[model samples]
Target: MAAQLNHTIVWCSNRSASAKFLTEMLGRPAPTHFGHFDVVELDNGVSLDFADANAQIQPQHYAFLISEADFDAVFSRIKDRGLEYSADPMGSRAGEINHNDGGRGVYFRDPDGHYLEVITRPYGSSG
Candidate 1:
């Protein structure tokens, strides 16, 4: 059997808020409380477990490969929320989306300042 990612812990100042923010942005179901963590599960079966951080939280990058339709829906939500987004990961190109790999892609920050990316095509793959 092929191995797959099960879950990963995301350090955040507020678990609930961070989890809720991610879920809403991705149009996924609301996170559920599990022990001390707030868990958000993606359609691919990988779960992002949000936990409170005792020290300073270092922002991390999370990229999601989604369908064009999903990207449209998610991008609309991002625009409606007035969240700042960029065409590139470094955020140089603001208020724009990139047609990287012939598919739409954008970058934004989560509530915890984690860089969140959504792309309709995987990088380096022909779209």
Candidate 2:
């Protein structure tokens, strides 16, 4: 069987709020509560199971491959909310978006400091 990404747990100080932030950013539907998790389903059928952390939470990176229109929309939302962003993942390039692979990409952090990325093209893909 072909392996596919199923789900991943995103530990957060507030699960529901984190999930809501992601959903809003990606223009996805509101997350649903499930078994101590706030489950956000992506269009690809992968799920982001948001859970509250009992210990210190180490921030993680989550990237989304989206269309040009979606990228524009998400980028606008990020700017509209006055969120700080960077073109590079390490955050060396602030207040900018990268045109890597000939597609636009931006990186921002969630409320819990989890780095979120939205790209119109996958890395290593030809433009």
Candidate 3:
């Protein structure tokens, strides 16, 4: 078996609110309650678990590979929320798409300042 990503742990100041927002934003159901934490599932079977603790929370960058149709739907929702976004992963400016390595991608942030991305192609060109 090949090694693969299993899940990610997200530390949030407002656990419930962050979980709710993320669940709704991802078009998935709210995470199941689990002993002072919640877990949001991804289509790949990996989960994004949330936790609340009394400490400074550093944002993390999580990228999602999506289909064109899904991209359109999610992008529409991003715009509807009036959230700032960038086509570049570095987030140099708003509304910029970096065709780096021949892949089309965009970046945005979640409520807790976690960086998020949607990509239609993988990085680097094979052809």
Candidate 4:
């Protein structure tokens, strides 16, 4: 393996709310019982951990590549939640797709203001 990803720790304002949002959005179950955090496992074997914090957390961008099917599903969820989304992964204005490097993608912010994205093709690939 060449520099495989381990996991991502998300410092959220509310652990329970963030975890619930993530779990429902990703269509996965919430973590069993951790000390003070909840773990969300992805299909790629990577995990996103939610931890409660008091300090103002700086928003970050986290992208996940998904199949066209999963993308459609999640997009529907976004719509159902009436959440504003951007075509660009950078969370620009609504209904904008940044064909950055020429790939299909979209952006939506999580409950904690974390920018999230789902793309079909990998960046810089000759697809």
| C-alpha positional error of residue 87 in candidate 1 after TM-score superposition, expressed in Å | 0.6
lDDT of each residue in 1-127, candidate 1, tens digit only: 8999999999999999999999999989999999999999988899999999999999999999999999999999999999999999888899999999899999999988999999998999983
lDDT of 2: 0.95
Model 4 lDDT at residue 78: 84
TM-score quality measure for candidate 3: 0.85
lDDT of 1 at 109: 97
Give lDDT tens digits, candidate 3, residues 1-127: 8998887788888888888877776678878887777888888999888898588888898888777677777788888998888987667768766665566677888778989888877776536
RMSD of each predicted structure: 1.3, 1.0, 2.0, 2.2
Q: All candidates' lDDT scores?
A: 0.95, 0.95, 0.79, 0.79
Q: In candidate 4, residue 66 scores what lDDT?
A: 74
Give per-residue CA lDDT, model 2, range 47-110, as digits (tens): 9999999999898999999999999899999999999999999889999999999999999999
TM-score of each: 0.95, 0.97, 0.85, 0.85
The list of candidate 3 runs beyond 4 A from truth reads 99-103
Give, for candidate 2, the lowest lDDT window spanning 10 residues: 118-127
User: In model 4, what are the clashing residue pairs, if there are any?
Assistant: 87-96
Task: Give the per-residue Cα lDDT of candidate 1 at 16.
Answer: 96
**Model 2: how far residue 43 lies from native, Å:** 1.1
- Evaluate model 1: give its TM-score: 0.95
Best by TM-score: 2
